[model samples]
Target: MSLNPIPNQIILLLLESYNLGANINLAILMSLIWNDLFLLFLSVRNIIVFFGPSPTLTKPLRL
Candidate 1:
């Protein structure tokens, strides 16, 4: 399996931010953003894997 770099970078950045100061709100926001980005990346990867070359097409059904 291939590695995903974005999630790793997000985690590293979050750790760095946490170490900076007691910015609870910023930390939470960073975590949320990281979570959303990771989830989105995973979902897109799943879709691509599920539908290889000739992906199924359905106007109303989107991934």
Candidate 2:
């Protein structure tokens, strides 16, 4: 199956990072790292919102 555009772009970035190898500059590397982290944060937030909280995680404490 084909990936949607967001995932496809992320994959392309990963491949580009690999291809750059040891010659890659620090600024490009930092940008890639931050972009990936931001994407990960957004994905996790979307998943949590879509599913809501788990029952076990929301269980009330006993007195």
Candidate 3:
């Protein structure tokens, strides 16, 4: 098993949004954006988590 939680989070988010009465078009758009954002977030998080500290530190980051 992988350590990443992105896939599960995305699935839950999609399901929750659907349950909240999002239309097909809106759901599709939201899912696409959500998936992209989650992927970006996970990649950056993995880079920092696996690589440790670097010289690029300038300010605190938020997810």
> Cα RMSD (Å) per model?
18.3, 16.5, 19.3
Local error of candidate 1 at residue 7 (angstroms): 44
Number of the top TM-score candidate? 2
* TM-score per candidate, chains pooled: 0.47, 0.54, 0.45
Q: Which stretches of candidate 2 lie over 4 Å from their true place?
A: 1-24
Q: Write the per-residue lDDT of candidate 1 for residues 1-63, one digit (tens) a residue.
A: 977999999998998887776577779899999999999999999998887644345345657
Off by over 4 Å in 3: 1-22, 54-63
Clashing pairs for predicted structure model 1, backbone only: none
For 1-63, candidate 2 gives per-residue lDDT tens digits of 875899889998998888777456766788899999999999999999999999878999778
Candidate 1 lDDT trough over 10 residues, lowest sum: 53-62
Separate clash counts for every candidate:
0, 0, 0
